[model samples]
Target: MKGTFPIEKFSHLSTPFYYYDTQLLRDTLFEINKEAGRHNFHVHYAVKANANNRILSIIRENGLGADCVSGGEIKAALKAGFPADKIVFAGVGKADWEINLGFDAGIFCFNVESVPELDVINELSAAKNMVAPIALRVNPNIDAHTHHYITTGLNENKFGISLSHLDQVLDHLSELKNIRLLGLHFHIGSQITDMDAFKSLCIRINEIQEHLYQRMLIVDIINVGGGLGVDYENPDRNSIPDFHHYFETFYKHLKLRPKQKLHFELGRAVVCQSGSLITKVLYVKEGVNKKFVIVDAGMTDLIRPALYQAYHKIENITSDKIEEEYDVVGPICESSDCFGKIVSLNQTQRGDIIALRSAGAYGEIMASQYNCRSLPKAYYSDDL
Candidate 1:
């Protein structure tokens, strides 16, 4: 469904702020939990997607665990009422303090990416006289068929351990006594719409599991890191992703050993549709060759367009006048601050409220103050 924006309510509020549909967010969470529960699967909400306190609280209420990538995320998750045991820390570069924090918090697992990281965790765990539970993040080298910037499973990507070095990494396991190896982790990439990529990953996981079994390395968890894509262009049609098919894909293709638990670290698909970046038109400049609809918001408010050339469905919520094509550009100093090129919107005018849909994921969280812009404040649908 096309999202409803309270244009009257927004009239008094400042421009360049986020509006979150809490009902939509809760609905999405319910669907995710229902689907994952069917297969006895576990879900850890990736905090890197959107760490808004309200968003995190709603997710925690749904009983989904936290998939934290940093110490701050862990603290945020904990502060938001997510149980410490439900937190799983995963990052390629976990500093000394972060690793120690994870150990101190007693998180579910640390998705270890390298031998040196494993050693550091071991050392830190040994200091605390505790055994750190960890899962080796293996590089399956499975092509996720996504943007090169978001792809992480390939050997060239520095995110996970290469298959070639797995044997050597396993060999060091016995030498490191403070960390207990729990399972294997595989995150192919982000915004993966293709089921074939995940199917390939499942097959690769099977092979890897068999090899590990031969070596007597029995794992209890199989964390297929989540990269489920949301329909950015048609957020209304597919507001909630097909979680049933996503979970079933694994059930059908992945051969899980008797009692192994399946885990997912979903980020974008969880929060992307529930939010919209609301901006106000500053001017409608008529250039010689092109018309520009300049907005008050800039790359500082939402950088996905400039950073990834990402497309967000833009709409003129205030005006129902005849639509026209105009380049939707932001008021940033950089030339790359444009949101969309030749965008069709309601007959443009100054002071028209524009809603950039499918911006809930990486929009506000990634906002920077490059030009000393004020951080965007978030408003909730229920509150209004």
Candidate 2:
């Protein structure tokens, strides 16, 4: 590592915790701000990926809005000091209380996924005697070019409203007095590496926008949901994603109307590389067929590996010995608890501090209390 981290100092106090490099986070945010400013784009940090209080505060300080998916998330964003006007609530199946909560909070707008959902919001807003502004999430049927599990823009997915139903939506728009359409929204998938997928989405958005404009629809906002992935295999080489390429893809392909503010809801790319999951080797066992390194940090601390078969660089930060092959695993009861199988790392021993790199996103935020484990505490470099 180019920068030194005092692993020895924290090894005595905790076996598993999240370590954040605030400097790297600031640099990533600066890149996002610089590029987004050039295009006059508005960004909302997707809180579903990572909502740690400190991390949320840092992201809020960057002046990006909060994209929340649930009622609890909206409450969390507010509790974290995100302005109501800068918060956007979205989900396919929002609860009645959740819609009422957003209505009371007066958030920016609800990203409505279905015509039925639109009716529900209108009903809720009508109950409160309030007009609710919304953006219709349009199903573009474009491939996200990522893992099959994450791709949501296809017709098979139950995410956004299909193009076949737009006529129905337009039919109801006149009747829904409490609902006001702001613009269109689209999100294909998460962790997409192919820039062409985004370009395809832009072309489709253009087609949709043109069709809507022909129907006398005035577009005020265009929300392209965030699914930008980051480099996990080589975290050292690419701590942050190429903001230039990402933004340029949109700038070149997306046809925008005058004064139409483009909104991006990014989560992973902004925070993934700046954090690491620090765990200590609880035991090292060598069997005839395999060598196993048991880590205190299980899938409970970071579930991306188990959930998405995701990869994060492993490092023996506290060891100086030669490398060896071992299957790094956590104490979880499930067979999927293995972090990496037959991975080569420094000759690890009991109590060696291990670091799982590129875990800044979907790491701590996805953590659960399974196996009766308490959530891991987080430490920032600024605090150290």
lDDT of each: 0.93, 0.89
In the predicted model 2, the residue pairs found to clash are none
Q: After superposing candidate 2 on the true structure, give the runs of residues whose Cα lies further than 4 Å from its correct spot.
A: 1-4
Top lDDT hit:
1
Instruction: Write down the RMSD of candidate 2 (Cα, Å).
Output: 1.2
Stretch of 10 with least lDDT, candidate 1: 1-10
* Per-residue lDDT over 1-384 for candidate 1, one digit per residue giving the tens place of the 0 to 100 score: 346888899999998999999999999999998999999999999999999999999999999999999999999999999999999999999999998888888788999999999899998899999999999999999999988899999999999899999999999987998988999999999999989999999999999999989998779999999999999889898889999999999999999999999999999999999999999999999999889999999999999999899999999999888889999999999999999998899898999999999999999899998888899999999999
- Cα-based RMSD of the predictions, in order? 0.8, 1.2
Residue 35 C-alpha lDDT in model 2: 92
